[model samples]
Target: MEKKVFLLPFASVILLLHYWVTCLTLAVSLTNLSDEYALLALKAHITYDSQGILATNWSSTTSYCNWFGVSCNAHHGRLTALNLSNMGLEGTIPPQVSNLSFLASLDLSDNYFHASLPNEIGNCRQLRQLYFFNNELTGSIPQSLGNLSKLEESYLDSNHLTGDIPEEMSNLLSLKILSLFVNNLTGSIPSGIFNISSLQSISLSANDLYGNLPMDMCDRIPNLNGLYLSYNQLSGQIPTSLHNCAKLQLISLSYNEFIGSIPKGIGNLSELEVLYLGQKHLTGEIPEALFNISSLRIFDLPSNNLSGTLPSSMCCNLPSLEVISLSWNQLKGKIPSSLSHCQELRTLSLSFNQFTGSIPLGIGNLSKLEELYLGINNLTEYGSEGIVSTSDVYSNGIMLLEVFARKKPTDEMFVGDPTLKSWVESLASTVMEFVDTNLLDKEDEHFAIKENCVLCIMALALECTAESPEDRINMRDVVARLKKIRIKLLM
Candidate 1:
């Protein structure tokens, strides 16, 4: 019985020694693997010109595990993470990066890495966060990437990668953000991408993707918030199932070949801020419900077959609207006067439409209006008569001449002149006096004409008259004198 007890203690000691040796072997292997990857990176032309080689760093001498951008567990010294983002590293990612079998995160984004991603990346089975975006990596996505079961975010955007998306990517069930935009990727979007339940944002814009938008996309990923499928060849009616994306904030499907009226249910997206469905072939009246979206800041649906008068209550409810573009359509009827209430409006384009009648006088009330494009419309003798005065036109002409003289000049100063400057000034002052009392509340108009117009033209006429003592001064000569007068006024 005593001998049996002694054997049990001896066996336990042997097992403990075995475990210690196994751990030592693991630590040495990791150190060797780290050095191998560093060498491979250096040989592959990846460099830090500012700091020279990472292997040459003093910390690497003590142990390869102590290198910069490398972290290991305190007890085991197994590499757990490798981050080289924004390091200005160029050249292909070394396939030996897979040597770090225990790596849980690898970040190499925002670099100048070229060539295709190494297929050996799949060997990092424990990787949870892989950032390979914003690089010059080319070639198709490797199907081996599907082996990374723990990947949470895959950002491969803004590259020259071509060819179809690998179907194997659908296996990454933990993916939350998939951004492949601004690339040369062709072929229709892989249908399997919709199966990722954890996906919250998908940016696939600026690609060569062609085909109708998948109808069940939102149903597959109900948690999606931003869907950017713009600048593609997508056609056919917008899928009604998109309304299922209740949390969607930005939906951009612009520059597609989609036809048919916009889905009325789009108004259901209460959280939506930007809805860009423009440059399509959609026809029908602008949905009234669209204007009711209080959260909408930018609503663009231009270059379509939409017709009918704009709803008077459009901007009445949307107080936060900043940009509304509905130009190049078949819409008719007078523009709603209520649009003047949009105090936040910066750009309003309604050109190339069938609308008729005078523009509302209240349009001038828009204090925040910066650009107003009403050309190619039937707005003849609209409130424009009140908004634009003869003096305003003459002042604008002088300002234009000043700009032109600064840019270029022919031998004749008034090569483009067609009207008499003196006559124009007299007519402008008379018209200004007549409308100044009715239009302006402040006395600035009178002062402006007296100080700017009268002074400018009087000096100009003097210059012209001084050029030639006697002669029936031509309108062209008067214009040249006006230009000189403008220069004198500035001095």
Candidate 2:
């Protein structure tokens, strides 16, 4: 009787152990199957796999972790990252992607992916880095994305996305870089975006966004490094508190409808490098304090109503100065000879202003000068020989006439006068005569404006005036060729 009792208890113990082992094995197999199914769904949705990347590599017979562009955690065997950038793959993101509950990073940049991002993406609680730039994806950003509390970087630029940036984006408290440029988005920028304290870069340029910037933009964003709000319709006075961003390296707020004087406080940012405030309605003198920033490289404040002569000691404190474009302003007085001190200067544009006197002869000392535009001013010939090169004269004249001339060919002013085409053609030959005296180098004057160079400039101008807009050269190509001509002149 004692032996029977001991054997019965031993048998029961073995049975319990077997049951627990079977349950653990089944649970692990189910977890593996779930991740595998999610990946298979993604492959099924891909319409065009040009290189057969998913077709050949992602198979049910293979382990999901071994698939191309995929990584799995060693301990838990869960998907952690998937990077398929520039893969030549085309597809819509499947909702089943949300099944990757352990996914942390997903990169689909530089591809041909189209269609709206799946709202189910918000369910991936572990997602941190998301890259969807340079795709053909359309539709507004999903508001459900705000649920990604741990998201760090989000790139959605160079797409056809329209509609307002979802106000719910404020919920991404851990966000750092937010790039949404080159889209068709409209409406005022959400004020809540400025309240995200952890943000480091905000790029919302090349859109139709309008409205005033928040009054206290820099108060909440202490770590901000770049602010690119250019090429938008934003209006109103620039906030006076912009200089509070101590770490700012780039501030591009050009091509807007902003009115009033530029906030002088911006000069206080010691780390500022590039400042572009061109093509706006800003008035008043260029702040003298801006010339004192030693780190400033490009100071572009063109096409505004700014007046007053440039400070004579402009280049004294600006050690890193490279390009100075202050064209189409009402600035007066003699061109400052002090500009010759900018050793790093590559481009110096001071055209279409009311400045008088000969071009400063000292400019010839800038051996690094590539582009020098000093046309359309009440200036005389160089008083000294071999002062500066006038190789870019013809092209500069073409741009000035095409961009600013108001007298049309059909206008009454041309009733008995030369037709616009004949006028341009006649002037093309004698264009060099009106070239600013400051730009001519008497020693190598023959090389300054070559005959072929003149013909090229005239051809470009005539093509630009084509009756059909499509017949004209692409503006991008025109600008690029002009830059090339300037470079060849120096060579």
Candidate 3:
């Protein structure tokens, strides 16, 4: 008919080019035998790899592309990566490792892998990183790993996981370090995973997560840097846009039950460094822009309900303060002789507070003060040393020797005695000659008292009856000169 109608359109264009090259050679031989039967179904469920190192080279006479945590791709040999980190590799994980469909990275971290997590690992689809941290895995998580879509770093931390947390991992969107912490996971953190903008670490600490905290924390993950919500049950407040993230650096929300305050612009971040909000129920007054965050280094807040008075210009912007636990709070004033300029302070807890005064003689210049807790406050000594004696129980040394021998401090049953430590060292050379008439008592009786506070209470009873205990005087330097003479008699 016209040469069979031009050879029937050239044999239907060579039969549609041999039917797409026989369907692309049967899809690259079923993707190289589906990566050797998905690494022989993860080495037949590896009952225990106890360093027989993948059971003596995962055999079949080798060449399953040279096995052992296989890593191929030498000019498209496929199976991209499988680290086997900390290789104490135990079992489980095998949903045939989703046939390692061109896996991009799968470091079985700190191995000991147990149950749940292999929802066929979303068939890998070129996964980018799924390190199962610490291991001993349990249920939840694995909503088909949000269909991967090239996932990027999802370390299932500590493991022993429980329910919730998988709001389909907010469809990945190329996630970045979403380490589900300690795990026993419960509800309420799925505010679409903090509106992931390629999250930069969102630990979700020791979970049991409760509500509140998604007021666009940090304008939607502006490259957030570590926000490990500590032992949870998280409550309201605290989300003052978390200081707009500004590349935050660790804000570990400790043992939560959170309540108001603490958000006084959290020092505007400035590349913060560890600001743990301990056992929360937070209240106000600690905001001196948090000591101007000079790249603070560990500023933990203890049992909260914080109060006022600590702002000595934030202790000279602490040159990298190191651990200042605001101990069991209800915190009151004066524990700040500008924290001795935070010379790398190391743990200073202000225990059970109501803090009255003195305890800061430039805290003997800190010298790396190691864990000091001013127990049940209303403090007295610490800074210039001498914590207590004269039978302490706030002994106030027999009421500072009856308020400096104005009478009856000369005990030992004084009848006509010059005893009480020789009548206070015979007035240590006339104790500044009674403050050389430094008067100023504009008061209408009721025991007026104010000749430089009776010459600093007779030079603090001759520096506590001197005669050497290093010449005494350290009831916090006489309560810091009676708090500068009671702030000049309350102005």
Candidate 4:
């Protein structure tokens, strides 16, 4: 009886061991066999496969492990990767793709696939990377995608995807890159998604998203390096906590309705490279703190209501600045002379403002100055004389020399003698010849006299430059003479 009982327990242990081994064997061979059907289903769903790689290489006759874009684990014989990016394939992604139970990576980027990402995608429990950016995929991102507990990266940008980002996305604790920019997404950003500690990059620009940016931004996403949320309806003050994102390099929140002063300590962000915050409802003086960020490359804050004087020491402070555009603001005060410190300043436009005072004379010293806009302002010197300024004129000399330079569009040889006086004086002998031949016909009247346009124009020039100011012809006489000249030319 004791031996029989012992044999029963031993047999139970052996059966348990056999079950585990059989399941292990099934797992090893299951991936390739299941992936063959999955790949075939994918081929069947493809309405347009411009390249016949799937038709040619993926077949029942060949091993599924040998198919193009299909990568398998040599040791386990499991389908671990599928990359059909830029393959010119067009069609819906079949739910059957999830049958590749051991798949780790799936890339259908830069293709024409147009349908909701299948909820079955979550079945690929080991999936670490999902690349479907630059496709025509529509409909909401499946909530089931949150079931991918192991997912590390997701790219769904440049698509037609709509609806709120699923709150279930917060389940992805390992997510590092979440890019869904340039989509048709609406609604406020899901605050829970920001809690993902491992996230390094988040791009949701060019969407219809609205609402105040969460004030606890840095606390939630401390590991972020790039945060692009531009071209949305975001309003309210830029959160002060943003400065705490010590590793942040690129911040683009432009084209929004954000109001109030820019965060005070933003300049303390030492790693910042590109800060684009244009077309917002922001106000206040240009912060001196901003100029101190030595790592700044492109600082754009145009089309705002920001006012006040720029710090005079900016040239010495901002050494890395390359592009700065502060146009269409209510800013006033002198353009700082120290701007020459930014030797690398490639583009500096400060147009359409109330900036008074002379442009800093030192600006001309910037050897690399490419664009300078300083118009529509009260910078020109004025006095009690309500007239525009001009060069000084002598009493008897009517400034004939400078006047001549303004007329003819000729070279240096014609510099001194381009006036109407010189033109007529050179042809004075021709007048006598015409009179003698009666070519200056009395019966011809105006046409005959008008034909002597050069002579009349010169006569008027001589009259205007007479030795006595009183003898100088009035501007009306010159106009009449010009009319006669035109009449003669037309005749």
- Deviating ranges (above 4 Å) for candidate 4: 1-27, 361-370, 380-491
TM-score of 4: 0.71
* Candidate 2 Cα errors over 4 Å, as ranges: 1-18, 383-385, 388-395, 401-491
On a 0 to 1 TM-score scale, where does candidate 3 land against the true structure?
0.32
**Model 3: per-residue lDDT, tens digit, 1-491?**
45543345878999999999999988987788888888878878868887787778878776677887778888768778878788787888778878777888989889888888878788788988888889898988878888886788888889889999878878888898888888798989777777778888888888798999976678887888888888889888778887777888888887788888888877888888888887748888888877887898778887778888778667697689776767667878777677878888765656667887767666556778643556567876443354334212122433454344433321113324554445555664554332232243235362254444555555565565454455566566767876887777666
lDDT of 1 by residue, 148-193 (tens): 9888888889888999888899899998888898899988877778
Error of 4 at 162 (Å): 1.1
Model 2 C-alpha lDDT per residue in residues 1-491, reported as the tens digit of each score: 45553345878889999999999888977887878898888888899998998999998788999999999999878899999999998988899999898999999999899998888999988899999999999998989899999999999999999999999899999999999999999999888899999999999999999999986899889789899898899999888878888898888888899999988888898999999888749999988899999999988887889999988899989878988888778999988888888989877877778988877767878888755667677877543435532323332543544353422232222335565555766666665543333433346556445444545656676665454445656656777877776676556
* Local accuracy of candidate 4 as per-residue lDDT tens digits, 217-298: 8888888999888888888878888887889999888888899988877888889998877874889987788888888877
- lDDT winner: 2
Error of 2 at 112 (Å): 0.4
User: How many residue pairs clash (N, CA or C atoms closer than 3 angstroms) in each of the candidate models, in the order given?
Assistant: 0, 2, 0, 0
Off by over 4 Å in 1: 1-4, 8-44, 47-59, 62-66, 71-76, 382-386, 389-491
Compared with the true structure, model 1 gives a TM-score of 0.72
| Candidate 1 lDDT score at position 252 | 83
How close to the true structure is residue 109 of candidate 1, measured as C-alpha lDDT? Answer: 86
For the record, the alpha-carbon RMSD of candidate 4 to the native fold, in angstroms, is 17.7
Report the lDDT of model 3 for residue 219. Answer: 89
**What's the TM-score of every candidate structure?**
0.72, 0.79, 0.32, 0.71
